[model samples]
Target: MLRSTIGGLLIAFLAFGTAAAQTYRPAFDPGALKGPRAGAPNMVMVLGTPHLSSFPESFDPDRLGGLLERLEAWGPQAIAIESLSGPQCDFMRRYPERYRDTVEDYCWDPAPARAATGLEVPAATAEAKRLLASWPEEPTPSQRRRLAAVFLAGGEQASALVQWLRLPETERQVGNGLDDVLVARLETLEGRRNENTLIAAPLAARLGHERVYAMDDHTADAAVSDKEAYGKAIMAAWDNPAVAKRKALDDALADEIGTDEGVLVLYRAYNRPVLAQLAFEGDFGAALEEPSPQRFGRRYLGYWETRNLRMAANIREMLGFNPGMRALVIVGASHKGYLEAYLDQMHDVHLVDTDTVLH
Candidate 1:
C-alpha cells in the first residue's frame, strides 16, 4: 500500500511537470544568415617590437633594413603602426597650437617638408603616390631627397626618416626648408615608439601607401578602478624584473642587428611563440596568484584585453572599407599576441604566418 501510494504521487508529479514544459515556448530568432561579403579573409601580420627608446639607449633605424625588406616583399595593402589614430594626426595637423604640446614629439613639421616638396599635407600625399608610380631606376640623389621631403610633408615622418638613412651620415643634415631639430626628432620618435620606422613607413611609401594606420590606445590603462594602487601593485610585481629582462633582450638584439641576416634573426626570436605566451597567458596566470587589492592582476589582464579588442575593432573597420586587404600591424611585443588572438576570432580575418616573415 505504501509503495503504490508513492508511485501514484510520482506519476502525478511527472504528469504536471510534463504539462508545464509542454506549455512553455522558447523565444528563438535566427536572424538572416550572412556569408563573407568581403572576398577573401583579410591577412594580418602582427610584428612584435620592443620599445627600444624606453631604455637608456636607442638603436639607429637603419639597422632594421633587412627586416624591413622582408616585410615590404610581403606587400601589405595597409600598414597599421602603433601610434595615435588618424584623427589625432588630423587634430594636430589642423591645430598645432592646441595639440602640439601634448601630441607625441615626432608629429611632422608641415612647414619645412612641405616647402621642400611644394605641397601641403593634403596634396603632398597624393603627389607621393604619383612619384612612386613613375619612379625611375637609378634615380638621382635629388629625386630621393624630394620624395623624402614629400613623405615628411605628407605626415609620414618615419618614411622620411628612411630617406634620411639612405644618404651618407654627413649628408643626413637638415637644411633649406628642413629644420635641424626636426630631423633629430624623427629619430627620437622612432626610438621611443620602437617601430622599424625603417620598416613600416618606408615600406608603405615604397608601395604607394598614403599613410599608416594608428591603432594604439591608452584609455584602458587610464580607467583602472583604483588607479594609484593598481599601478603600484603592477610596478611592484613586474616592473623591475620585466625591465631587466627586456633591457637584456634589447641589448642583445641591438648587437645582433648589425650582422648578416641579424635583423631577421632578431625579429624571429622576438615574435616567437614563447614570448607571446609570456606576455598574455603568463601575465594572466601570475595575476591569478595575487592576493587582495594587489590581486588586480586579473584586472591588468582585463585592461590589456580591452585595449587590444578595441584595436582589433579598428582594424576590422578599416578592412570594411577595403575588401581583401592585407595589413601588417607593427606593435609592441606585448601587444602582438593579444591583437593577433583577438583578430583571429573574426571570421573574415586570416592571420599571416608571422614566422615565415620573421625567418
Candidate 2:
C-alpha cells in the first residue's frame, strides 16, 4: 500500500515538472537591443587560429606574409591576444597552491624586470600607462626604449616587442632601464614562433600602435578530488567517433600549412560556422553526456564555460573603454565561436564577418 502511494506521488511530480518546463519563457532578450544610437558601432573581428607552436619545425614564418598583409589592410586601431594580463598573473600568484601550475606554464616572471626598473607589476603597469597617456607625436628612440622596459617589468612581453619593433634596428640597445638581460630577452622574442610575437606584435608595430592587449583568463581552473577518476571519465567521454572525424580534418589542414595559400585555407576552415557545432560535438557536448558516478563531465563543462565567459567579459571591458574603434582579437580556434556569441549580445558591439575579411 505504501509503495503504491509513493509511486503515485512520483508520477504526479514528474508531470507537473514537465508542464513547468514547457511553459516557461524569459521575460526579455538583451541581445535583440543593438545600439550606439549616436555614432559608429564598435567593430570587432575574431580571428580563430591554431597555435603556431604546434606547426612543424620546417614551417616557414615568411609564409605568414600574405596573412599579415590581409590583416593589416583591415586597419585595426587596437589588437588583443590570448595571453594573461600582467595584473591577472600577479593576482593569481598570491595563491600559490591554486595557481602554481598556471603561473609556471603561462605567466612570465617579472623578477628580472623588477630588479632592473625597481618596480613591481602594478607600478610598472602604471608607468607604462602614464607614459602613453601624454605620449608625444614623435617619440625618440630613448622614449621607446623606456616604454619597452616598463612593459617588460609589467610582464607584457608582446607589448614590449611592439615597442622594440618600432625602433630602428640600430636603436635596439641596452639603456633607459632596459638592462642587458631584458635586451637579450627582446632579441630572443624576435624569432619566437608564438602567434602574439609573429602576428599581433609585429602588426601593431606596423600600424604605429603602442601596445597589444593581453586578455586571457584562467581563474576558472578546477581542482578535482579524485584526479585519476576525473581524468578517466573525461578521456572516456572523448573516445567518440566525432573526435576521430575532427582529428582527421585537423591533420589534413595541418599538412597544407607550409604556404600562404594553405595558411589562409586553414584559417578559412577554422572560422566557418560549421566548425563550432563540430567542436561542440567532439568536446563539450560529448562531455555533457558522460555517465560518471561523480558527474565529472558536468564539472569539466562548468569550468570550460566559466573560463570562456571570463575571457568574453575581458574583451567586452576592453571595448567599453573606447567606443567606435576597430578591434582585432586573435585567439585559439576553439574559443572563437563562444566569444562571438557572447559579444554579439552586447548592445554596441558589431561582429565583422570573417569570410569578408579572410577573402
| TM-score for each predicted model, relative to the true structure | 0.62, 0.95
lDDT of 1 by residue, 1-359 (tens): 99999999999999999999999866752222223674576788888877644533445556667777788888899888776542346556556554555355535455656556577776777877798788876655566666667777777666566565555566655653456655665566445435646457667767766456667654454344577887667655564454556557767877775644876787787898777766643355456554555468777777677878888888888887787888998888888877877877777777887887766
Residues 1-359, candidate 2: write the lDDT tens digits. Answer: 99999999999999999999999988786678898788988999999988999889999988888789899999998999999999989999998888988899999998999999999999999999999999998999999999999999999999999999999999999999999999999999989998999999999998999999998999987578899999999999999988898899899998888899889999999999778877889889998999998999999999888888998899888888888899999999888999999988888888998888889
Error of 1 at 230 (Å): 3.1
Superposition TM-score, candidate 1 onto the true structure = 0.62
Residue 229, candidate 2: alpha-carbon lDDT: 97
Cα error of candidate 2 at position 4, Å: 5.8
Candidate 1 clashing pairs, residues 3+ apart or interchain: none
- Model 1's alpha-carbon lDDT is 0.67
Give lDDT: candidate 1, residue 219.
44
Clashing pairs in 2: none
Candidate 2 segments whose C-alpha is farther than 4 A from its true place: 1-7, 18-25
Q: Which whole-number lDDT from 0 to 100 does residue 210 have in model 2?
A: 95
Question: How many backbone clashes does every candidate have?
Answer: 0, 0
Model 1 Cα RMSD, 1 decimal: 9.3
